[model samples]
Target: MSTTIAPDRPARTGEAVPRATAGAVLGALMRQRLRRDRWQILIWLLCIALLAMFSASAIDQTYGDANARAQLIRLAIADPTIIVLRGLPQGTSLAAVAFFEIYTFLALLAGLMNTFLAVRHSRAEEESGRAELVGSTPAGRLLPTTATVLHAVAVNAALAVVTALGFIAAGLPAYGSFVAGAATAGAGFAFFAVGLLLAQLMNTSRGANGFAAAVVVLAYLVRGIGDAMGTPFGDGTHQRSAWPTWLSPIGWGEQFAPYTGDDWRPLLLQLGLAVLLIAAVFGLQAVRDSGAGLIPERAGRATARPALGGVFGLAWRLQWPTVLGWTIGGALGGLLAGALGTVINSSIADNPALSGIRDAIGRIGGGGSGPLTQLFISAIFSIIGVLAAACAVQTVIRLRQEEASGTAELVMSAPVTRTRWLFSYVAVGVIAVLAVLLAGAIASGLSAVAAGEGASTFGDSFAAAAAQVPVALVYLGVLTLVFVLVPSWTAPVGWAALGLGAFVGIFGGLVKLPEGVRHLSPFADAPVVVGDVDWTGGYWMLGITVVALAGAAALIRRRDFAIG
Candidate 1:
């Protein structure tokens, strides 16, 4: 027999093997990541940049006079609620005011973007068994992580440049725009390291993502609290953050003080933290087994519970922890709404100039009453609606995950109809939406009463919560339909839609977006519970939800189970 040698194979198996260089491997991996994430990255970058540009222009238009900007600053300094919701007041300069109005939000988005990037490349790949496959090649384990880090750095660099250009395009000082960009990129890199380390620790991609996202949110809230507690100085338009702000990456971003102080030292703090975390990640990667996390998955029950007996029960079991987390977040928003609404109302009573702030909030929340308390409740609950909508979106995404992981095939192997399987998850989504809204309503009502409000506040709380229900249902139903029609686009499309809807619905009024465009957001159509209350929007949303859900049911039966 004649032996044929393959050109791509080694001349002899027992002889030395020719492996690719580490630099070549790293470049290949980074190129793969960029190609995979190009569209996602583009969307994120565009949204963030538009936010900066629009916010700068909005501030310029609304607070044209320095006196007006100063008054706005003084009001924010006095109202802890505003400070907690906005950002630390730097100064009354047009540039400073723009940075103060928008930087925190920018940093929050950047952090989320980076963390998701990290988790997706690390734990998610490992979970899909791709990491092990890569490990068996010249790329190996540590080199892949190194590539991820490099990819993150390059992405953040692009993010920084675009962000700076966005502000500069809005006619802010060029130098200060660059500084703001640095702040955003710095915070993002820090969060990226946090996600990388968590990926090394958590047993599953879902667990890592949930934990990382929670950490990002917690950092933002902590920074907000510190800013709200800050002491005003420098003509009462500048305030230094309290000590608690130092504890968060988002807080570190704020300390950059772009357009006012323009401090660059804070970048060092962010870089240092990233270095430490990245070092720890590399250490863990070297020591731990491939395709396994440092933390072990808990052993499952030897016998399944009664709740595992049916599809709906199994769906709830898998999803309740996520639902509970969102419910708690809604409850917290309610708690803040009730407690802070009273304090702000009293402040507004003493300072009539603050009524503009109240009015703007009312408009963002749709038509509402004149009382500052009522307007504040409307605004906060509008946010809670976003939370409930997010829960609904995630539920639909979970169904896609099950199908992609090949688990749906196993489930379908049992005596279960596809429509029934679809309905089971849909039912759980409905329950989760209701649970979040109900928790918020109850918490808001109790806190309002505790704050010495009248019994009627309960009516207001439930009404606001009820108005949000239709909005949440619309998101659930429509996104479920999307999932059924385009299973692969489910996660990306769902999150992007949510993010766009939230920005348009919550900040559209602030930016003076066109009325027709604003009305497209479900949040803008939420029912107003106050004087001459209109339930028309809610009724319309309910109709849409029903139609969408029915369509999803019809379509879900037509698709094959996906395993990707």
Candidate 2:
């Protein structure tokens, strides 16, 4: 009966289909963004919040007396270098002093966090071909960008709330704490706009991240210069910043003067800048193709250089620019160490009022019962150690990037063994470590002598730099092993480990973290050269580095190339 002939039916191809609304698409995209970044964003927020809480609590305990806080502010105002590294001294009140010692670092971390978040969702997705796939769907190109902006806004808003609560939990004034949180969010959002705009101009995620980070750093440096040159107020514990401070988003955060001024007007500058940059980013997206960059990459040479003949050579060729950048940073840290070391010593030498402040600064370098000058140099060198370790981490992470991009597969076709390939990158990391430390050592010594310090400080500078070598090497070796065992974890794990270690090591004591937890950071365990010259930690780290590298070399052969 069913076999009876039926009239042909239309294919129904012309029927309208339900299309997702822009708002629905936007929400979905935002959900995806949040899901991917929840852990990372949480970690960043926690760190920022912890910094605020710990600094407020610690400052209240250490400088409880108003006169003591007043002396600290006066010292910071007198030393331009202190002003360069810290914030504008608003007043001598406990809350104001806490703000002075901590705000610049908070702004710095926020700027970096926002820039990386911007690049990760934008250029990184395009590089993986996901952008084109999404573009072909109903979501389209621009909505994804809109979603990204909204995601960033949500994160920054959380940052503002988290930071405020952190301060208030530690007994800071509630209104001023919220004002400080708002200042942090405003500066972070402006940096986010900068990163999104740069993503449109760069050909790759790597280039975009590098340029955006450089801009953030440059803004910090410029603000420091302007603040350092400012005019001190009649109280001798406050300063009016110069014009150059107005040119930096970080500088704008300083203008908030949260505890003292409690002004909301500076927030307007941050919001206005963000609005303008985001508008420009949208305009660029409207005109440009999905996978292309506004600024085209330059052409390569017709023939390979002799240095490109080997795997190690190739790794060096790819990473030298990165190495150079970190080296310059080390030099700057060194210069400050030299220039400020003497100033720090002379100020703290016999001042009973500043003993607590002196102890606070000394704790950063894992303080020693040595000469005041040596303690100051060690503290500055600890900061330099951070730069070197960061360079090492980036070097190891580059291997993962190569594998994910399929470049490692092409290089493997040449009969190179997996272990050798891994080792080649490790060798480059070693050289980078040395280069950064050496630059720091040289700059520190020269600057110290130029600052009228004794020539003997040259030896101290070299020793301090040397003490940091094993600490950096440990990071390189441990992270290289992580790359081999779990390729996808390289970036997140590397950066997270660095941030945690630095926090625990540099500020752990200041924040009164548990002794056991503080001891776990490589930075905290670095050799102390000031007193009796302890090298026990350095020796242990060297052994650990060797073992880790050996483990990585053997295990790398078992895994196949990762898919993503």
Model 2: lDDT of residue 342: 80
Residues 1-564, model 1: lDDT tens digits: 994333453222122224546676788899999987887888888888988887898888888899988988887887787787678999999989988888888888898889889998999889888888777666667778889999999999999999999999999999999999999999999999999999999988778878888998899899999998889887899999999899988899889888877899999999999999999998888878776888888999999999898999999998999999999999998898788778888877788877777766676678667577777888889989999999999899889888987888889999999999998999999999999988988899899899988887778888889989999999999998988887877877777777768777776776566678678789888888866689999999999999998998898888887777
Over 4 Å off, model 2? 1-20, 342-361, 369-372, 451-454, 507-517
| Local accuracy of candidate 2 as per-residue lDDT tens digits, 1-564 | 463232243112222223445566678899999998887788788888987887788788777899888877886776676688778889988888888878887888899889999998898888878888776555667778889999999999999999899889889899999999999999999999999999999999888988898899899889999999899987798899999899999999989888788999999999999999999998898788887899998999999999899998999999998999999999988898888888777776667555665666668778677777777788888878988998999998789888997899989999799988999999999999999999998999999999999888899999999999999999999999889888877877777678668767887776456679789899999998887789999999999999999999899888899956
What's each prediction's TM-score? 0.93, 0.90
Residue-level lDDT for 194 in candidate 1? 97
Please give me the total number of clashing residue pairs in predicted model 1. Answer: 0
RMSD, one per candidate, in order: 3.5, 5.4
Off by over 4 Å in 1: 1-20
Error of model 2, residue 79, in angstroms: 2.0
Summing lDDT over every window of 10 consecutive residues in candidate 2, give the lowest-scoring window. Answer: 9-18
